[model samples]
Every structure is written in C-alpha cells, then in structure tokens.
Target chain A: MPLPSDIEKSFAASLLDKDGRVPSDLTSYSSPVPQSRFNIYRNNVHVALIDMMAAKFPIVLKLVGEEFFRGAARVYIRANPPTSAMTINYGKGFPGFLENFEHVQDVPYLADVARLEWLRMEAYNAADRKSLGGEDLAAIDHDRLIETSFELHPSLRLLQSEYPVYSIWQANIDGVALSSVDLNSGGEDVLIIRPRLEVLVIKLASGHCDFVRALGSGIALGEANERAFESHEGFDLQLAISGLIGCGAFTGFSK
Target chain B: MTNLSSWLDKPIPARAGVGLKPEHFAEILDTEPDIGWFEVHAENYMGDGGPPHHFLSLIRERYPLSIHGVGLSIGGEGALDAEHLKRLKTVVDRYSPGLFSEHLAWSTHGDIFYSDLLPLPYNEATLETVVAHIDQVQDVVGRQMLLENPATYVTFKSSDMAEIDFLREIVARTGCGLLLDVNNVYVAGTNHDYSPQAYLDAFPFEHVGEIHLAGHAEARDDAGARVLIDAHDRALVDDVWALYERVISSGVSVPTLIEWDNDVPSWARLFSEAQKADRILKGAQTEDAVAV
Candidate 1:
C-alpha cells in the first residue's frame, strides 16, 4: 500500500494529465472501473478552476469567447494550479499567462485587459481608508508641502500599457458600442482606485503618470514634479494634483 | 477557556437558516425574515473590508452566525497550511461565530489547491492524520470545530474502516463535533449503492452540532449506473426531503441550513426553502413535547 502523501501526489498529477491512470489502490464497490469513476473528480476540479478563472477575467473571456476562453483557461489552470484556497486570489498569474499563450498572439492587447480586470479586483478588495480632500492639501504650508510626500490610498493602482487598454476595457465590460481604436495613438496610462466602494479607472496624462509613479515610490513633491515636467512638454502640476485629489488617490502626508 | 465558554454560550437555535448570498443582502435586511441563523463561507469574508463584510456586519447584529469553511483541507497528508490557519483565526476572532465548521475531505496537496472537497481513503493512517489536523485547527482557533461528512463518487480499495467509524473515531480523539450533511448522505448512498437509512441509523448523532441540506445533480456513471453529484445549484429533491424528515422524526433536530451556492434564486425562493425546513423542525419539536 502506498503512503497517504504518495496517493495524494499521484492524484494531483493525474488531475492535469488526461492519459494519467488512476492509482491502482482505488476501487469501487460494484465495478472494477475505478478509472472511469475517477474521471468525475478530474472533471470537477477542472470545471471548478476554469469557472473561477472565467469569473476573475470576464473581459478576457468576453474577448476570446466562451469556447476559446475555456480551452485557454484549461491550459492555464493545468500549468498553474491555485496555491491558496481563496478563489478570489486564484488568478494572480492569469495576465502573465495570457501574454505567453500562443493562441492569443493575434489579440496582443488581451493581456493588458486581463491586467486591468485583475487590478480592478484588487482595488475592490483593498483596505478601506478615509481619503484626503482638497482642503487637507491646502492646509499644508508651501515650504513644508514641497518637502512632504503624500501617501497614496491603499486601493490605488497605476498601470502603463502599450495599447489603448482603458478604451478596450470600457467597450467590452460596459457594453459600449464598439468603435475602431487607433493603435498608433500612443500608449495609455491609467490609474485605478476605489474612492468609495466603486472602483474607478481614470486615464492619466503621461506627465501625471510619471509624477504619481514617483510619488508612490516615496519621492518628495518637488522632485516628482521635476520628473513629470521632464517626461511631458506641458506638465500641469496643479491640474494633475487636483485631478488625483478628486479621485481620492491620496490618504495622508508626512515630511 | 474563557473564549471557549463564550463561544459555547451562544448556541444557534434549532431552526432552519439559509446560506447568506450577497444577492439577497438588501431583501434580507429590509424584510428581516424570521431566520434561525446565517452561515457564510469563511473564505468569502477574508478580505480586509468591502461590501461582503459591510452587509455581513449588519446581518450578524440581528442573527446568530456560523462560519462554514470550505478551504481548510483538514484531511490532507501533509501539515496544515499555517497562513491559511492564521487568516481563519482572524475571521474567527472578528466574528465569533456560534459554530465553526470545515469539510472532512482534503482540498490541497503541497501547494496545489483543488477547490472542491476531494475524498480520502478511510483507514488508520489517514485517520491519524485527520485527527492531528483537527487538533491543530482547534488549538489555533481556540474553539471546537464541526467536521462535515463529504459526498464521494469514488471509494478507495485501501480503506479498512467504514465512514461512520472514521467520523466516530475523529470525534472521540479530537473532541470535535459533527456537521451532518444529509444531502451528502443521500448522494453518497445512491452512488455507492448503500442504504441511506442504514447509514443514518449507525451514525452517532449525539455529536452533531449542525445539519446541512442541499441539492445534488443526477448523472450516470461510466458503467451506465445511476449516480448523484452534490451540485448545490438547485432545490432539494423529494428523496432528500424525506430523509431530512426522517432525521427530524428520530429526535435529532439540530440547527439546519439550506445551502444554495450556484444558480442562486430570488430571495423569496431561497427563503421558502428555509421555511419548509423550519416547518419540519417545528413538527419535530411538537412530537418531542407530546412525548415528554
């Protein structure tokens, strides 16, 4: 008789391989077809994991259609089984999986869309905190403000992609009328945050993206604005600051 | 000891309650149905703070709550995951659910997690592993947990014991209670060609802390034999209802739960199912009173 760990290892391996045989130690009451009965478990595991991925990446499923999405998801799940029992945390590798997926090469933008969806899920579940307001920013002295670095909200996420992922995500998820997007219209940068309870995706100017990315990494205000100005020709510090504040991106600050 | 005493003090009433789904949050809060208690999957509320916790807090204020965990994998061969246990402890401390329960089957091996409850061979070795796992869980959570019997489609040849004996021994060793899932009994009974009644008769219902009744899907096995899958996506079948009535009539009226996970129906439909179970519970109480 095999040890319990040996049986478990074999069972886990067999769940991913179709030609894998059921362990000889297993038996049914009436029939000798343990292999046939084992298919039920294999099918259950696959279907459950595939459904979890589908729920996590609905826009990815929508782009690939159900049949293709299921096929791709099966491949992804076989390669990367969940490490945690929480289904919500199951698809952390899915966006990367789509990038290397041979079948999805035609839709190069699919991976970014998956990334957007994953970010939205993260933002939705991120720790809740009271956001800072415009008045709070105004309360700071000018000299100290330059030396102060603001803390971004826990729910805030920044993304820069080589495609117009924001428009594509909106079109697919919101059921907006599909319109042709210019691939040559430069790369897009987006800021995702949950201000209240709803996750909001805001398109950011290149300069603002640079500024927020720097500040998010603990850079002081003056240095962050300098990097923003160097990145874009017309970087408006006041406009960027006000826009991020309105989106509830910052929580508090320290010198 | 103090924590355990506090947990034991708030016992869920012996009536019917439905699994709380996010879809019915508004209706439940608005109508305030006379539910016995509410049960939630512990994994669903592991997040820091969101709508899941927001609504659950309001609902918990009104009714007694039970945390039914599906991810603990207590029957696995290796040591239980420490991080998973810590998260579970956090939730347990936060909610202080009247009853905490997990399945008898394993869902993880090494780092790979199969979300569904997978079957285990019933033998001395496996029994020892499970008892130890339960002991570890109980020690960490600071309270006793109810171990639920699993619905199996396949049996192992290496098994040297019966399911009832395995459960009985688990309770004897670790001092844990049982969460008798009646639908699982019916499903496993039909799939394995055993008498559900006989299984129930041999079961040690004295250790039962809660009861679960759910729906199963009907399918044919490879040999063209009839089998039932514990789907939990539909209403309870007539046969399962009959078995539940049998359990109640036998003077084992525990806290019952109506589990509807997938293809969730409207608030009215789900509440009606609970109402049906509630009526049976009332009938059982009346019978006991008359006997007394």
Candidate 2:
C-alpha cells in the first residue's frame, strides 16, 4: 500500500503532467475514466500553483520571457516543491535554482536578477519598522559608538553579487527600453534596504561593502570598521557611517 | 457563551471587501478604505506572531475580517489533517473572523501537502470523506465552517452524485453553510460544457452564507483546445459579475466578498470592485423592501 504522503505527492505531480493518473494504490474500485476525472482536478491544481508562482515572481518572469519562464517554473515546481503550507514564500530558493540551472547559465546575471527580485518581495512583506533618521544616530556619542551594535531596519536586506544585478533588474522592468547590458562589467555590491517606506537598492562604495555587510551581520562599529579596512584598504569610515546613518539602515544602537 | 457567540458571529455588514494581500498591508493601515471587511488566506496567518499578526490586529480594529482557507482539502479520502486543524483553530480564535470558509477540495496526505486545492470525485466515498472532514474542522474550530464549491475541469465516470447533490448532502450531514463562488460556477460550467445558470439553479441558496467573485485565465490544451483557468484576482470578468447578479436576485443576500488574490491592484481598484458588489446588493435590498 502506498503511504498517503506518496499518494498526495503523486497526485500533485500528475496535475503538472498530462497523464492525470492518481497513484494506483489510492483506488481499489474498478472505475474506468479515473484518469479523466483526475485530469480535471489536476489541471485546476496545476494552474493554480503556476499562477501563484507567477504572482510571486513577476519580475523574474518578465526578465526571462513568459514562455521560457513558465517552462522553467514548471521544472522548478516539480524539483523544489513547496514545503510550507503558506505558499506565499514557496519560491524562496528559486534564485539559487536559476543560478545553477544549466539552460539559464548563458545569462550569467539572470540568477542575480532573480535574487534582486526576491529581495524586493522579501522587503515588501517584511515587518514594518519605524526607520530612524540622522537625528537618532547623532545622539550616540563617539566614545560609546565603538561598543555599540547597530540594528538594521526591519526591511533592510543585503544582496551582494558578482554581477550587476541592479542594472539587469532595471533593464527588464516595464516601460524601460530593453538595452544591451554588458555582463563583463565588474560586479556591484548592492545594499537593498528599505530606509523608509519605500525599498531602495543603492550601489555600495567598494570599500564599504565589507563594512555594511559586517554591520548587517551584527558586528559592532569598531569590529566592522576593522573588517572593512582589512578587505578594502583605506575604506572611508566617515563616508560609510554617514551613508548608513542617512539611509535609516540602523534602527537603533546597542550599548 | 457571550464570547463564543460573539466570536462565531460578528455583524457581517453588506459592504465590499478585499482579500488581504501582503502588498497592501501598509496602504490598508495608512489609508483605511471604506471596505466592509478584509479576507485573508487562513493558511497565511498560521505562522506564530510577527508582521501578519501586527498588521492584521491593526486592520481588525478598523474593519471586519474573514478567514478564507485554501488548504483544508475537505473532500479528500484521507482523514482530516489534525495539525492543520489545530493551526487553523489558533488563527480563528485569534482573529474571530466574521466569516470562516475553506474550499470543498483536498490538498494533502500526512506529511505531504500538495499546496494546491485538488478536487474530489462527487461520489458516495467522497461524500463520506467530506462530511468527516467538515465535522473534524467544526469540532476543532468550534463553529460551522462554510465550504466553497470547487471549479472543476473534468468529471468522473463512476461518480454517482451531481455537484449540487454532493454539496446539499454535505450541508445536511455537517450543518455547515455553503460559500457560493459564482466565478467558480461559471468557470467550471464553461469548462465542462454545462450551463452556469443551471448550476446556480441547483445550488442550495438557502444554505449559502457567503459569495465569491474573482477573475480567471485561459489556457490551450495539448489538443489545441481552449480551457478556462480560474486565475483568482486578475479582474472581475464579466461572466462572474453576471452570475453574481443572478445569485443575489435569487435572494441569497449574505456577506459577499470580492476575492482578488493574484496580481492584486491598488486599494482604490479593489474597493471599487467591492463597491460594485455593494451597489448590486443595495439595489436588491431596496427592491425587496419595496415589494414587501
């Protein structure tokens, strides 16, 4: 006897295909046209899930034309089937899938573009935080700053990639003219943080990439600054600090 | 009893409502639309305390809320998912939705959840399974849940029951009300080559406590056949609205919600759809009162 889980998995898989065969173990009845009935239910379920994916990853779909995206999506669905009952976050690992997908490897930046899109979704759904301003950061004394850890804003997301992800996203967005983007251009380190109500993806100063990343990973100012100097010599402390502060990336400082 | 009754029954005002998508959370809180209520997927709020709770609490203060579940899988052959039921119970108690509804389909078996609402054959075996599942859900949630009809693409050769008969039987067996999704009726009727109006005529309107209207998509089959895919929330297609008019004219004046789950539009656009429903319901009410 097939376990219920296996039966359900097979049923879902059947929906994504034309066979529409329910797991043979599910039925003992000598019913003809079982496949036909299953086909109807299968189509509804398959299309529903596809529609869900399309809604969740619109930019990704737009970036890779619809026909290719849907074809790739059906494959992704079968491989990394949803784990959570809340299908809203079902395609969380899609970026990674696109990165390693053999067919999409030609578009080296496609995966990074997908990551950017995913971050956009994450920032959109992330908890709303009262983003602090320059006034809030000024209150922290320099003597205490070294010992203090900064809390990234609730919607703050760091997407560092070896490709020009922002430009790739920009080129595909609706109404934006399609242009030949040079893939060989040196990589960009993007800070995808919602400083206020709107989520913004600003390119980072090469030197401050390590600094913001360390701070985002819960490092104190003194330690993150040291890491920043080690990674990129002469990393500008004043520029990075002022930029982070101005963007409302730091919600609060921990003494 | 006061709390339970209050919990189970909140005044469902005849106004338009929007499916509470994550995209519009901040907007909904910032610019509170004159929406009658907000509906959410019960499964989405199944998580432990976080943003969903934070925003939902804020929205609940200003608008009546409804919990529309997509994963209960009420018509499956397997036993009702106990853990899923418990999670649902937690959300229901937390929000106390004015109306709680789930689709009349199944989506899981033990650890494997398909994450899609798959239909059941309308037969004796399926009927028994549906009744058992409904009883289980009601027992866990402490209220009668409404089961929305499924939009089907195919029929079973061995199925002895009609879709209407199957629903009427479930209503009788479990005492749960029906959530008449007119768009679903139209989609299924057209897909299966049946009259949408005929399905509505057979629907037990007296037992219906809610109505759903949403948009759909079209797909071509392998044999070059065009099939209607019920892509919820693109727009309120003309056929669905026409079906709604027919349903309300038949005197089923429940708290109707305009569900737009995918490609959700702006708050104004969503509320406008709700406004359309509100207008029709209002016209129906005035005509009824004048006649009486």
Instruction: Pick the lDDT winner.
Output: 1
- State in Å the error of residue B25, model 2: 8.9
Question: What stretches of model 1 exceed 4 Å from their correct place?
Answer: none
Model 2 / residue B185 / CA error / Å: 4.3
Q: Distance (Å) between predicted and true CA of B36, model 1? A: 1.7
Q: For model 2, how does the per-residue alpha-carbon lDDT over A197-239 read when each residue is reduced to its tens digit?
A: 4667777887777887788788999999988888888789999
Model 1 TM-score, 2 decimals: 0.97
* Range of the 10 consecutive residues with the lowest summed lDDT in candidate 2 chain A: A25-34
* Candidate 1 lDDT over residue span A85-190, tens digit each: 8777889899999999999998998999999999998988888888999999888889787788989999899889999998888787779754666656667989
The CA lDDT at B102 in model 1 is 97
**lDDT over C-alpha atoms for residue B80 of model 2:** 68
TM-score of each: 0.97, 0.78
Q: Per-residue lDDT tens digits of candidate 1, residues B88-202?
A: 9998888889999999999998888998898999999999999999999999998889999999988887788999999999999999999999999999999899999899999
What proportion of the true contacts does each candidate reproduce?
Answer: 0.72, 0.17
